[model samples]
Target: MAAMQNITVRGVALCDKKRAGNVHVELYEKDVLDPHDLLNDTHTNLQGEFKLYGEQDELGTIEPFIRLTHNCKAKPGCMRVGDYVVPTDKLGGVYDMTYVPLDIVVSGEGEQCI
Candidate 1:
């Protein structure tokens, strides 16, 4: 078995029209299924910030992305606001994605405020 290395991912979730807080963020290896593929998940802080940590044998094998869920209490379903792929090639031992903007428009009738 190959040795595992600690990898950290950090980013901020921002909404162009909203406060951008309380958004759910999930990190997953692209094309992998749930339970085993889910590396880390967390909600954005008051300032729309979050961090995730995981271990992998090689950084290249971990094709990670941030899935943002906003307006979770929608009557029909939760909105998958954005899916941002982290550029692993630009990553060192630690990856800092800086800020990921989630711009979702809540239109139509009975659209609840986030």
Candidate 2:
């Protein structure tokens, strides 16, 4: 039988010491052979704070992670995307990211001008 697994994530996003509001954040279940499954998504509030809860039903463990997309510190027509992995043990509970900085450019991937 498939069991439902869930997780909660909360945090504030910042850029150059200022609140980065409206930042896009999404949770996903990683898949090796297919597209990753989106579990939950939200935009940071005006205060740059966000809390998200996501649930998935599966027969085995689900590998969860987060993806953040923002325009902080980007060029006039570009955006930045970053991905973070959630500890498997944190499933069925909360994972606090605390304060995250969006100004730091993601290495290698650079910025996407779309």
Q: Which stretches of candidate 2 lie over 4 Å from their true place?
A: 106-110
The alpha-carbon lDDT assigned to residue 69 of candidate 2 equals 88
Per lDDT, the best of the predicted structures is: 2
Clashing pairs in 1: none
Best by TM-score: 2
Steric collisions counted per model: 0, 0
Candidate 2 residue 77 Cα shift, in angstroms, is 0.6
lDDT, candidate 2, 9-103, per-residue tens: 88999999999999999999988988999999999999999898999998789899888889987888888888878899999999999988887
- For model 1, the local distance difference test gives 0.64
lDDT of 1 at 52: 82
